[model samples]
Target: MPFIVTDACIQCKYTDCVSVCPMDCFVEGPNFVVIDPEGCIDCSVCVPQCPVDAIVNAAEVSPQQAEFVELNARLARAPGWRPLTQAKAPMDGHEQWAGVAGKRAHLRLTW
Candidate 1:
């Protein structure tokens, strides 16, 4: 039961979860970080570290967020994504987007 990074993480790109993940399984994208399903150990350590509570065990996701389960998998397997093992500041003025919805429309999939 690997965890999934959902919409709350869309534009925030918070690195708190990355810093604590024992497996270093997170992959960084333009405005998000995804958990590589194959590398994740279903550990809950990264859950609480997410400031917006965006990380949820795959089995526990709501219907609206169910897409993220597959999203994380696909993006984790995508090329050009960087591995994030250290914590960093959130995107500039991240506070404005921390909990915004409908952010998927703004997701930068190519970079």
Candidate 2:
């Protein structure tokens, strides 16, 4: 199974995970990120890179966050999602976007 981006990643979109993804499986969404199960190699590189611990393998994901696995897969196949580079570096620093827990700012508008 592929790595999943949990709700913790909403609005934050830390992007550190995006840089380390070996298969370019991470795709940017309006307010969050999604993993392409079809392309992910399960390298687990993105897991540690996420500052909020939003990236988790399907099997290891908490039950509450489990829906993200399918959400990532579905968004990955959706039209307009762009493929990120796999050879980039881990995102540095703290979470930039605040109040993500209260509102899904990324989902409010189409990107």
Relative to the true structure, how large is the alpha-carbon lDDT of every model?
0.90, 0.71
Q: Pick the candidate with the highest lDDT.
A: 1
Candidate 1 lDDT score at position 9: 89
Any residue pairs clashing in model 2, and if so which?
A: 16-91, 31-106
Between which residue pairs do clashes occur in model 1? none
Q: Encode model 2's per-residue lDDT on 13-68: one tens digit a residue.
A: 67777777767777876666788889888889888987777788898987777677
lDDT digits (tens) for residues 9-98 of candidate 1? 888999899999999999999988899999999979999999899999999999999999999999998889888899999998689998
Model 1 stretches with alpha carbons more than 4 Å out: none
Each model's TM-score? 0.96, 0.78
Model 1 Cα shift for residue 42 (angstroms): 0.9
Task: Provide the lowest-lDDT 10-residue window in model 1.
Answer: 102-111
